[model samples]
Target: MPAVLSPTYREVCLWQEQVPREPLPADPLPHEVDVLVVGAGYCGLSAGASAATAGATTLVLDKEPLGWGASSRNGGMVIPELKAGPEKLAKKYGQLGRDLYAEVDAAFDHTEALVKEIDCDYVRSGQLYLAHTPSHTPHLRDFAGELQRSGQDVQFLDAAQVRERIGSTAFDSAIFFPKVGGLHPAKFHDGLAKRALAAGAIVHDRTAVTGLRRQAGGFEVQTTRGPVRAAQVIIGTNAQMDAAVPELAKRILPINSYIIATEPLTADQLQLIGPQMMVDTKNLLFYWRLTPDGRMVFGGRNQLDPVDVPTAREFLYDNMVRIHPQLTGVAVEYAWTGYVAMTLDRLPHVGTVDGAWYATGCNGTGVSLNTWLGDRLGKVVTGQEPPPAFAELKHPAIPLKPLSSSYLPMVGRYFALQDRR
Candidate 1:
């Protein structure tokens, strides 16, 4: 018999393999609901649960299976801040910036509480942001000082300290956030789905919402299955918004991020790399963490164009080896790619547009922010709370829609050059 070849792309990730399989809902889709939630990722599910709790008849619809997008595909780091530093944020919005920081801090606290309540394998191992070059150390220091002023518990580690903690000499210095941590993304997504279902929200997977039109009551949502007349509609399809909502698509530039997981490592290998979620200080960042099962999961940004799985796997593996040369010969067990929604301002936007509400544009920090926004939007729809402060910010559409794909590669190359310097 001819030798069997391993598949290049993984059908599912390591996190998906750990969680119990989610079967499609058996009940038929209702023709009407109080609130219709599009996209069953973290945000949608979170909104569904909160809406149901607030006595709204909520239904969540998704094009793929639950947790099919970045919710399950992310690096699983619960970062509470945006790409912008604290000082920049304070300088820009002043009091509003401080309020935004407080909200994100609450999100971080809520995430830890939710993880414990959901009984998932979450580690409070914290996170380390490494400086990729000597010149980056000052930036890290400034960032740490700003965070400290904001009441965040952060420490700046020198090269020797970084090596002691990370067991790698590739980084120059590091900023350690003692509150951040990692969790099983698929498991957390599953927990949210179950909570939503239990809270009386109907979940319909593999049911894509194609269009939305304002009607007499609220909006008529056109879906693959049928039309759903909802009193209100919330779009939570971050990064995967294709043709569903043209307005949202214009505001979000979807970029692909790839990840690779190595085979299970020994106890000694685990000790070499300390138990902390790690990321580098680069415009095009590289993030990595050890899974609960002891596998090294490393991820980074890739070219804007479509890339084959083998190529993505090779690229991620080379970067992983560059960080830790000892893992040179380790076999990669899984490789996958997911889309990240990038906005013009590099911040998340949550507000109403054209009679429909939305919470998206995570800009690479989605795990905690998505959960908070989803729940907060649900409250806003139910009249339980006001719109978040982020809703006040302007969300402008990208300049040229037809030529957007070429933009990311150019930006990535520029950032790569800066990292080399």
Candidate 2:
């Protein structure tokens, strides 16, 4: 397959993905606001909601309708913590590891609370990381042990126990993290946007900002519809963020992640997948879960390509049937794809430049980390003390070098190979 060819996003966002929405009208007036947030994805919505609620005249704009990006188009697996475990974190960040973990835990809690006020169809059932191979089982155990040693709550399940929970004998072991869970991402973003609007944020969907320039006291944004002036600007778009800032665009590369939903299966077929969100032990990293409608949603990493509905559906039909042959007869009802902002370190970047602040590059953990950083960034903008946890993060400008522009494919292929091992 070509490196850039990805399936369409509509196919697998969720069993019942939110439908396309009409655009919100442009801001009637050009006025200065306390904060100007770009990208209506989770990060923007959360930050905009918090900022507007905190008494700032916040303005949020998106290229597509609200929740049209990866925020509403993702796997919906709410895994907490950095992709690396404590051992790797310590190796990479030293003393900062503990603080980061604490903040990640807090992020999980924040997501739960945010979901409560909205109707996102959230389920706190937690997540199960299954190891299909015996070799992978030790990694899960060691990671769970490290988490426990760091005073986090995680459980290790043996082969038989894993089968009991997942209804699959394909895995040798599993690690369950109650802090992580699943939800309907589309609903969450939409609900949050509404809350932000109610709290005084001026949201303009289908409004893409064409240019940004520094002005006297703050900045000026030129949009397709009109201009927005704000003392401070925020870029909340994650993986779908392309060219908002040239430096950030280099640090974060967009990769296509595809998913497909199977038609509602019979009770017998539903038994094959229990009430658990699963990420298998493969470099391909298949994460799947059973939808409320008894349909199976399966996702995997695919090349970034020009995608459409038909192409996405075909890809899902091929991929989903491979995981379970019994699902061969199960027709695919949807196929879709989304962009994830992938960083070199797989950690989110949260900082400011000039007078513009940004929280991007959540990698694949935008659902939790974006909301976490949104709340954190809101505090920073409001002159309130930011949580000490984020103090450990060293906000350096992402390098805009040749390797960043040219070597992403090579680096991605290497990491993909490692994940396969």
For model 1, state the Cα shift of residue 124 in Å: 1.3
- Each prediction's total of clashing residue pairs, residues at least 3 apart in sequence or on different chains, is 0, 15
Model 2 segments more than 4 A misplaced: 1-22, 27-29, 302-319, 387-392, 395-420
TM accuracy, model 2: 0.88
**Residue 370 alpha-carbon offset, candidate 1, angstroms:** 0.3
1-421 in candidate 1: lDDT tens per residue? 1111244436357777677565775577899999999999989999999999999999999898777789988889988888887778889999887777878877888788799878668888989999999999998999899889878899999999998887799999999998888888998999999999999999999899999999897999999998989999989999998897898899998888888888888888889997899999877788999998998999886555557666777787888888887677777878788889989898889878788989999988889989988998999999999988888888899889778676756767777787786
Candidate 2 residues 122-195, lDDT tens each? 88777888886788888888988998987778899999998777666777898988877788877777777788
* Per-prediction TM-score: 0.96, 0.88
Q: How many backbone clashes does candidate 2 have?
A: 15
Q: Quote model 1's TM-score.
A: 0.96
List RMSD in Å for every model shown. Answer: 2.8, 3.8
